[model samples]
Target: MTTPDKPGLRERKKQRTRTAISDAAIDLFLDRGFAHVSVAEIAHAAEVSKRTLFAYFPTKEDLVVHRMADHEQEAARVVRARPAHTTPLTALRDYFLDGLRRRDPITGLNDHPAVRSLTELIYGTPALIDRMQRFKAGGERALAEALCDTTEASDLTARLAAVQIIGVQWALSADNFQRLVQGETADGRYEGAVRDAEHAFDLLANGLAALT
Candidate 1:
């Protein structure tokens, strides 16, 4: 098997610049709210020209939501990379628990002020919500395709698993986000969140059999 080549120094620097721009944009958005901020203001704050900012982010909303892309294909990746003996659900269970421990933002376990503010901004903005829905659709498709690669699963089976897997992830994290938005502290809920995630994943892994 051929290993994928690592990004060159130039590519790494470009990613750093992109992250810097997004961080700057989120900071600005949080300071004054997303609707009040402009592309020019974000570009200026990031110390990049408008053209350069556009090169990195296609739309103003993309600046805040691009981070979603980082984990968007994760479901597919876990399935494809899992040990041959491991089931896809088991692989995802382990990954999700690790994210909980690390306070991964996607897991919605992270409660940094910036994280909360950005989530609130996205939830408040209709445009961003629509964009994210489309983004997640692509992720689901990727997961289905990955599941198809396994001989044990039929297309119907694969699609069902893909949908259920993504559904659990979105549902669990969303509950946490809503709680945080309602004034709950991350540290306060950390233990319960971990237990909730565990229960959610256990359901996925064991299904009705676990209920019996």
Candidate 2:
């Protein structure tokens, strides 16, 4: 008998493996905290060999926190892709507002205990925090390049604008995460934070016009 063709089989297999590993890592980290978890345990729980797990997630931390890298890259992409008339601050404001409306986990809408625990784990871990800072720096560099592409500003001006925009976002995200961990509902904080973010962006856009 001829073997049946498996359409989209490779993609599905890769996704399944990735999901299994991520779920297993999250479960273990929530149960025992991040520092105590090992790659072998994550591999075992996911029913994959250590080598297979490494193929999906190069590090134990990657299995638990892969989505963050995608988010930072996407933020820079959105700014770069904004319409010619739209300023970078405007693009970032819209992106963050959309995130708030969707109650995205990155905006701290998560209510699960495990999610909160993982946030605490990330904050408490120095290595993970350092990695996150590096990720943010890379994202800022990408954004600065994009800004430079769209404007005639000097390299220093573009870099400074990118730093200010990213720093504001980082602060806002931390505020929302803290609110979530403190048992505040998303709706309770959404309106106030949105207003604050708008004002913050307005200042960036107009107050910094002379510099730009």
Candidate 3:
């Protein structure tokens, strides 16, 4: 293979490895529960050494949860790439509304029984909950930095705004997930979530003005 072909092959191989690991981990987690499924078991199921699994996912929780981290980065990117006239809040609102329209899992539109079980497992497990908190904190930090780069808001103001934005998203996601867990279909809450998100962002935009 030429140099370009070499990189393409490497990328494809890495993706295959990642998919294998994630598929194996999810299967084991759903079959036996997240707590009962060890990294060794996941590696064995994927036919990879434990070291290879670790190279893909640093922690067992990551096999299931790091996807959320990727989402946060995408959100930050959207905000950063917004039109010059657009506000950070507006960009975030649009991003979320788009997700809602698509019935994205990040907006808690998931219908899979396994996904619901995983959500419950994460909430019920103290360690997973802690990891989630840290993930949120990291996302907030990245968003704050992005906001600061785009707005004239003071450092504290930008950070506070980022926190408020992320918190609203978190609440909305949790509410949708809880509704799903309670047997409500995505169709049941789809319109409600969009309306609620609009109101939530409106409050943030107006509240910031009031504080100033």
Candidate 4:
């Protein structure tokens, strides 16, 4: 996809406010369990009114996962923006590989302490897990729509293909995350992650290429 223009001053100020709120919430959630924290406490820590906090983040869970939600449209954007000669699968594979190379947290190849802590929090909390699932579902729908629009595939085909692709991507990311949690460095896991990603995408191509 084409790069988005920089936000104007007003939008930048809003983003800063949102970031402060999210940071405050994460600090509280990480110090105390997610269940123990309250939205009022977070708003107090961030120095924002409850109404403003709610405006930026509709729910408590959102304050933590808004970072991940930012990326929910990534796959669809890749598919929609791929070169004409490239298959959607190929474009997605390339995009994922680039993420791996950059150690992008979305690829689960990042071992930054903050990312790990947030991941642990998400996995440990039921509400956050549920929210994450909803985000994934939204991502899948967006990708399926992109597949239909870009490939002229039937709705069913696009949906099924999106399911498989998203599932594979999640599996790959989880595996990488698990390895990092087990003490492997991202650099150490890079080769295996790349190998697994390539194999996974090849499997996808075998099954879905004809339809696309």
Task: Compute each candidate's TM-score over C-alphas.
Answer: 0.84, 0.88, 0.91, 0.94
In model 4, which runs have C-alpha deviations exceeding 4 angstroms? 1-7
For candidate 4, the lDDT comes to: 0.92
Candidate 1, residues 38-137, lDDT tens digits: the string is 9999999999999999999999889987978878898899889988777777788889888878888897877998788778888888888888888778
Q: Give per-residue lDDT, candidate 4, residue 199.
A: 99
Error of 3 at 81 (Å): 0.8
Clash pairs, model 2 backbone? none
Residue by residue across 83-128, what tens digits does model 4's lDDT show? Answer: 9889899999999999999999989999889998998898899999
Find the candidate with the highest lDDT and give its number.
Answer: 4
Q: What does candidate 2 score on TM?
A: 0.88
lDDT of 1 at 94: 89
- Give Cα-based local distance difference scores for all models: 0.83, 0.79, 0.83, 0.92
| Candidate achieving higher lDDT, 2 or 3 | 3
lDDT of 3 by residue, 9-116 (tens): 889999999998988898887778888988888999999999999999999988878656687566579888998778777888898999988887777877777667
Model 1 Cα shift for residue 187 (angstroms): 3.4
CA lDDT for candidate 1: 0.83
lDDT of 2 by residue, 1-212 (tens): 97865868878988888998898888888778788888888888999999998888877767656857687666669867888787667777899888888877776655566666777878877767877887789878988888788777689998888898888888887888888777787788888778877887787877557533
User: Where does candidate 2 stray beyond 4 Å?
Assistant: 1-7, 112-114, 210-212
Error of 1 at 75 (Å): 1.2
Model 3's alpha-carbon lDDT is 0.83
